[model samples]
Target: MLSSNIFSGPIATDAPPASIGSRKDHPVPRLGIAAAAPIQTNKFYANFFLGNQTAPTYLHPYSVFWAGAKDTSGSWGMAISHIDANQRVYGSETNPVTGTPRYYINPVGISSICISAKELGSTTAVTSDALTAFSARIILRASLQGASVIEFPLVQGSAFVTAVFNGACPLIQTGIFYKTVTRSTKEARPGITKYKLYLEDGTTWLLYAHHTKGDPLDLQIINNGLAQAKGPFYGVIQVAKDPGNADSMYDRTCGVYATDVELSGSAHGEKGTYTFNFKKAGMNLTTTLAMFALPHHQTSFDDQTRDKMTDVKLQTTTKGIAIAVVADSWTMVEPSLPVSIGFVPWLPEAGSISNISSTNKTFIHNIAQQEMKQDILAQTDQPSMYFAGKALAKFAVLIMAIHDILGDNNLAQAGLERLKQAFARFAENKQQYPLVYESAWGGVVSTASYANGNASSDFGNTYYNDHHFHYGYFIYCAAVIGHLDPSWIAANKAYVNMFVRDIANPSPQDKFFPVSRSFDWYHGHSWAHGLIETGDGKDQESSSEDSMHAYAIKMWGNVSGDKKMEARGNLMLAIQARSFPMYYLYTKTNNVQPPNFIGNKVAGILFENKIDHLTYFGPQPEEIEGIHMLPLLPHTPYIRARDFVEEEWNTYFANGRAENIVGGWRGIVYANRATFDPKGAYAFFSTPGFDPSWLDGGASLTWYLCYSAGM
Candidate 1:
């Protein structure tokens, strides 16, 4: 059970803009979901219900896509693909002779095995009717009025794909062009049928059919390579990758399947414990259940729980290999959750920093006054929500530093008034591109795409891309304003809570939004890609910004006096610290990625099937590494490890290499350097004739100087 205080207050009350309505130009079709409530726009299983519904949905060890649709190879079932390390293809090397390679990518939608029913063919219809946080139900039925209907439950972490047949016969097909299909009867179990499928490449797969309420199935291979069972059957069919001990492994988790996962957590002082309780549908309670645990999960498992782990380790596309663990529940504890730091530079030694030299204080106050004179409207009224929100957050930080660190009440009060006016532009729905409650998919989205008739407008906000990155900055700004003046919270709490619910709603009790929309608890991170179908699954480019989003939630909870919300944010930040080092931030000791690809230091664009060292905007080295370090905040030092930062500096920006960089990237590089060398970073920012162009649109000299000095 979740803590009673996890979510209760303004977030529980759903409020949309008064004049908002559904956009007419969006292309998403409401498939089996009839709630008329808000549907999840960015989740792991979204590819199964979007577009032609043939794109791959990766659930770790196994990935499945609809194959009968026109978008795929035109087969009549669900195609499954699993890739090992040997199956990966490498990109071009940086140096022809001695340099390391740029990337390594796994193959997608190979269809090593296809699970189909005899009644499914060209005239069959496939629809994703039911969806949840961890599983989705894909329905397959023939076009005939009286045809049998089959349902396949695709669950995360389950090694097998289970299909429940209703008056239909099983037909096991393959796009891999199988070389042999052999029926095995070595260990006979009641109500169970077994077969081994061998592909041309010497790969073997195990198929087990469990009899539920009908006669046993007699499957045989005919002239074609596919195996087929006789007609008019009712039972469950399961398919799995045969590592070894096929009989023993199948018997342990024979007739059971995971339907969904229930998540709950609680934080006490500096520690937090979170759990994943699987909801299973079949089999007895004493039966052993098998689920795959990632590297991060395995590292945190207790000694007693780890003793039950098997030696079967399977390769995942992006987040290293997953180990098979036999358990129904998994519990992990984050020992060092960030529970103290507030709206100031964070010091692990003393929580928050206050001491500063008189000279530096005078300089910072002077810079703040100069920057505060500029027009706030011109900075925050842009068409793009990402940039405009960032601008608002930038000024909010400057105002806080002036009031908290420098003790200038009048100057801070003046700037706070202008900041509130700028914030009202979006809260009142009066920006150039106002937001609307997209009734079709059921969350707040920008009207820029619908107005211009382009899906890519505003960085695909209308289609559900980077919602957290766009709205997190505003949440932080609201927290600062509400902290300075508690009276302001009553006027704007609903509007601010709407943005929080759009991205990080913690409970499903609020019917207008899904729970924890952006963060994936299983993956220990949040994904940015949404709605669009791609050869690779979801990808997140900015790990630093991801941490910033979590930091904003923590601060907002503190200001709003929501203890559980604050605790949840602290747990999320701690999880990011543990998971980022294993996958995204590569150290020399890492054994997860390929040996030759570790020299790059950073996983630039991490996709499900590939890890490419580049960004969607450009191929510059500074841009690739700088995306993970922008808008430096109080949580920056806690998330970005010191040793990793030292290695990154030596590898890319050492020996005055950072001095040669131009534009806002120079400031970003200097701010990141402060994690290791505070004095050097302070010198760079406090230079007599500092160029304002060197600062990013979302960064200020006052915040950077104070951060460096405090460190």
Candidate 2:
């Protein structure tokens, strides 16, 4: 096949290889490791060549050269399966003698490079599978030049035989993987331009693909001034398994293409190549085929967004984790969990005491805590990983609320356990991590390599990290899931501790990785803004229980029965009241209104910046911390239901939002389903609402506020 020389040297020669950087006869693939020239526009992103978890935006480990930039330049993923998983054609690999000990050869999935193609005149992409394959069929997407027509040559390496061109193709595509369904030409045009397809199976068979006619040329194939064909055009096609092999040339024996179809606009160009590392698809615990399909976009939202709550929650959880067998699409997610969507529906108040029962008047209110937990407010700009966390969080939140809403504690408890199982997939040692770009689910991602590289956005528990928000929010879930069969909480104490510690001192490091200076896409904004590493944020000096840390201390207090935890919560609450921007105005200009509070989101302040008038908006006057926190803050939905009696909550039904006390913010985008300039305080009506396809562009956050002091 290949001139037996490609396998030039002994692969595993360096037994107990000298440590890296050693100078004595060092040889470990002598690989080139140059830093790819950085694109100056966005400095924060370094995924183009860096092998960190945050830069998972590019499919460098799995995609092929022909796939184009799913996120970056020169990042094609390739893999080597343990076995012939999805059998493809034409390739080669060396096999050791029968009794010799075999090396771990195919563990990476792909065996070798592939080289095969036909002339420009060919129609079908089919290549003949003449020789035994040592590799698989490589996929190529033709999206360059914005032209509908494309011509790819069937090649072995530098050389080309024929071309595979789609002349006068009407339908232009955005991504590769376009399906060919049309049986014949929609029209006909000039000089060998009108092409059709046929096939044969062999190496280097004669190809037959036609070019569209330049003008209305005389052709018998035209019917009433139009051209159409009922059957597949005739042609010779060829195939191969690996490109290195000498016999890898394509032929028509396999019906790849018939003879005599001319190619007009065919040209050969070079696209960089890459080597992939793969494994048995099942080895990674990707349970369903649905995981491999293209990704379904999460519903986008803006600051304080108020819609698509359910869909966002569902996509977050269901996407790469669960395999839905029974029903397809959101319309079918059954036994709908109790959801408290935006705005309690207006059913005219049927006068107070004269009614039979308070429950009758406050039907939605009876399940207020339960409904609130289920009322997810997912935004469109969130990372899919964020959605993954949402999925788990949604399930946990709903289950915890079940007992309160339906008075079925057992069902709620059962739901938590199921949720735990789902969340476990994203956890690294029982602690959540960001989701994979192409989660082993239906939604495929192409933005893994943007300046906004944020693979860890959804699962991290650092204060600013969205997953941190989820971690604190999910504490109630942990209790329920472990109530019945308790083992996880105690077993993963380290994880719990790390989570708590990170929450207390969520600093620039926790918010980002490497350093803040590496990229600008990342900046501290208190939400999934991007992977901003500022070397700032709130860094802690000690892990010991202290008043400075409220969230962490509260968590540990609940779990460890530590008194200092409560004190810390108290102190943290006090600090937050002054700095949180919920009630204070920034004075950025004379404006920045509705909610006058100027928070990191409203003020565009990085954590590293000092809180002086010159840096931050300055602390507000007369701010009360924990004094007003309790009446408004609902306890974990589960605990509230179980601990608080009916009498305790009945008063809440009469007046929920009388205080006008504003606190937590989801984001402005969350309030309205449109984009807003982050620099501005309010959303602009001048621009059209974001087209759903551009969810990432106009993503917004929704803010939440406690409504009353009476509770």
Candidate that would win on lDDT: 1
| C-alpha local distance difference test of each model | 0.79, 0.23
User: Which tens-of-lDDT digit does each residue in 517-566 have in candidate 1?
Assistant: 78888888888887787768888898888888888888887888767777
Q: What TM-score would candidate 2 get against the native?
A: 0.28
Lowest-sum lDDT 10-residue window in model 2 = 263-272
Which stretches of model 1 miss by more than 4 angstroms? 1-10, 17-25, 31-36, 69-74, 93-98, 144-148, 186-189, 245-247, 283-286
- Model 2 scores a C-alpha lDDT of 0.23
Query: For residues 1-711, could you state the per-residue lDDT of candidate 2 as single tens digits?
Result: 111221122111121111111112111111111221111111221111122211211111111122122222111221111112122121131111111111111112221221121111112221111110011122222221232222222211101122233333221111211122123243221112222211111111111233233322122322211223223222211122222222112111111221111111100111111111111111112311111111211111111221212211101110121111111111100111111111111111211111122332243233334333432323212335434433443344344334433345565555555565554543442222332212111111123232244433232221123323344433333443443335666654443433343333212222211111111111111222222332122211111111112333343444443333333333233223222322121222212121122211122222221111112222321011111111111221211121121222122211332122233211212221111111121222112342223111112111111111001
- Model 1 lowest lDDT segment of ten: 1-10
